[model samples]
Target: MTDRPLPNLDHWIADLAPALGLGDVDVPLRPLLDLTRDVAHGVARPAGPITTYLVGLAVAQGMSVDDAHSVVTRLVEERLE
Candidate 1:
């Protein structure tokens, strides 16, 4: 790998989203990041990506992002209990 620094999140997303056919979608970065952090800490490290993928699937299936996040957040909270 080159020694170039990685792009920041906004720049990275701007470059990547269109390539992934999500050019018009407004990605809510903070909440998703928070959710993944919670999942990684409260559940398992690997579950972070898996949970985010599930949330993405839910959004594609017509569930609101907030609702999907709420659901997963609850699950993580419960799991930590």
Candidate 2:
């Protein structure tokens, strides 16, 4: 099987969110992208999305997205250090 390059996720999300009833929702793509990079590099490739899912769960539980990203990022940085 040939490896296919992924599309620009941030662009895709911005384009698709409106159609998915999240038009007005502002996703903090920068922090999330940063978290994905950090987690994938510091931990494991699969951990990136898993960590993002946890961050989303935390947000749903009343934690700010920024705060969730900060907490996870800090943990990854500390563990990798």
Candidate 3:
């Protein structure tokens, strides 16, 4: 995946994040992507809108490229709750 600086990231995150939960978590793009990838792997599921948000969070967090992949992979099995 190509990494590009998110221009409307904050707005996108705010819109994507569900109300009455997490309270607008300002996750960096790196963590977000990592979380999504991990979530996918954890559930053996494919990428989706949720995963996109995770990627955004990861990039926003300033996570390293490789770390983003690893951390997000961890989320694959996690229950999003």
lDDT of 2 by residue, 6-47 (tens): 358657887888987778666777778778888998999999
Q: Is candidate 1 or candidate 3 better by TM-score?
A: 1
lDDT string for model 3 (10-30, tens) is 677787675546566755575
Best of the candidates, lDDT? 1
Clashes, model 2: 0
Worst 10 residues of 3 by lDDT: 72-81
Error of 3 at 4 (Å): 21
Worst 10 residues of 1 by lDDT: 1-10
After superposing candidate 3 on the true structure, give the runs of residues whose Cα lies further than 4 Å from its correct spot.
1-47, 77-81
Runs in model 1 with CA error above 4 Å?
1-7
| Superior by lDDT: candidate 1 or candidate 2 | 1
Better model by TM-score: candidate 2 vs candidate 3: 2
Sorted by lDDT, highest first, which candidate order results?
1, 2, 3
Once fitted onto the true fold, the runs of candidate 2 whose alpha carbons sit more than 4 angstroms away are 1-11, 18-23
Clashing pairs in 1: none
lDDT of 1 by residue, 7-39 (tens): 597788888989998886688887888888889
